[model samples]
Target: MCFSASASFVGSAGIALVGVATLMQVRTPRTLLFAAIPILFALHQLLEGIVWLGMDGRLTPPWPQLAGQLYVFYAQGLLPVVMPMAIWLLLPSGERRRIVPFLLLGASLSAYNLWFLATLPTDIGQCGHSITYHNPRTREMLVAIVYVIATCGALLASRRRWLVIMGLANLAGLTVVALFRTWAFTSVWCFYAALISIMVYWHFRRERMARHVEEAPQDHHFPAGNGP
Candidate 1:
């Protein structure tokens, strides 16, 4: 959760660096989409920093409201779709088909949430060590369950070990936030997700290294006649 400007800034900077490192490890355009997750999360944290500033009265009028809306736009509107799509893209050809249902579910959830966000009124307030985003229309048990299935489900469906671990971590985070800090679930969960994204960097780096090692023998080996 973005409790203060400093926490938000620290998270933003740290995740930004991890994002860049993850991007550099990308082997193809397909992987690039998933690699960008940390970068997007970094931006997400930055937006929350603005929201914090606005709520604290450190920012001018309208900016706080605008920032809060933008934060929700990402938190509620875009992520549901993007998370599954990213995982879907990262899956192997055989596994890709299996994730379609989750992808569709995510898209549907995103659409419904976007509509609700646009049509309903929203309120943001500080509570305890977190910020609470109030949008009654968007909060429902079914919706929350579907959201978890769409986002975390896709990751869990992945054949990649690292992705499965990431999914499990996210599920744990979601469960904790929902159980204890339902009011601040969005903020708290996003923070947890952003932190977990460091695993993305580790995954990519490991893959890249494995690829290098796999190619090393081939590069070193040569035709018998061509060998010096």
Candidate 2:
């Protein structure tokens, strides 16, 4: 999937449209973060396109380096925390307890990533037509385990059906990415997750439509207007 900049650009454009639509559907703050997922992914992909261009020597230096750094910053440093926190925001009070632990863990992981990203340089390279991003600090076995728990765990713990479904989808994708492209985990997995993010729109759209249906006025017929 990391074949070329064109793929990344085209994918980003499509995602941006879906992302905008999803944002338009948001009616409350609780859903705003979740709904913003698609657009965030769109931006992420767009950044990757710039990285691809830079990597391919079509773009100048510093720009590509900057793009790649930003990409890793979001995918590795910020995403884990956002995933669980977004899930937590969508869950009801009763359902929130299940998500809190992941939220805490994600926060920890994000903090760790931020520290490492600031202190260390993320090494980027090409592997099997994919971009590989590596931060020595984040590449530890324990960190990978915790990263999964923080992101996917919260989604799975969610009572919301769409979130649960998305969680399962992400888990399945994660397994494949883990098995096949471990070196490109950060890049490859994020690409898959970007596609998965479209469900964010679908979920919000379904929710908004359901709300509309519930709020729609119901007609009641009187028995031949007897009082009149």
Q: Which tens-of-lDDT digit does each residue in 113-170 have in candidate 1?
A: 9999999988889998798888887788888899899989999988678889999999
| Candidate 1 root-mean-square deviation in Å | 2.9
lDDT of predicted model 1: 0.89
For 1-228, candidate 2 gives per-residue lDDT tens digits of: 388899999999999999999999988888789889999999999999998998889999999899898998998789989998888888777778989999999999999998998899889888878999989999888998898888899998896788889999999998899988999999899989999988999998899899999999999987676564
Clashing pairs in 1: none
- The deviation in Å at residue 217 for candidate 2 is 1.2
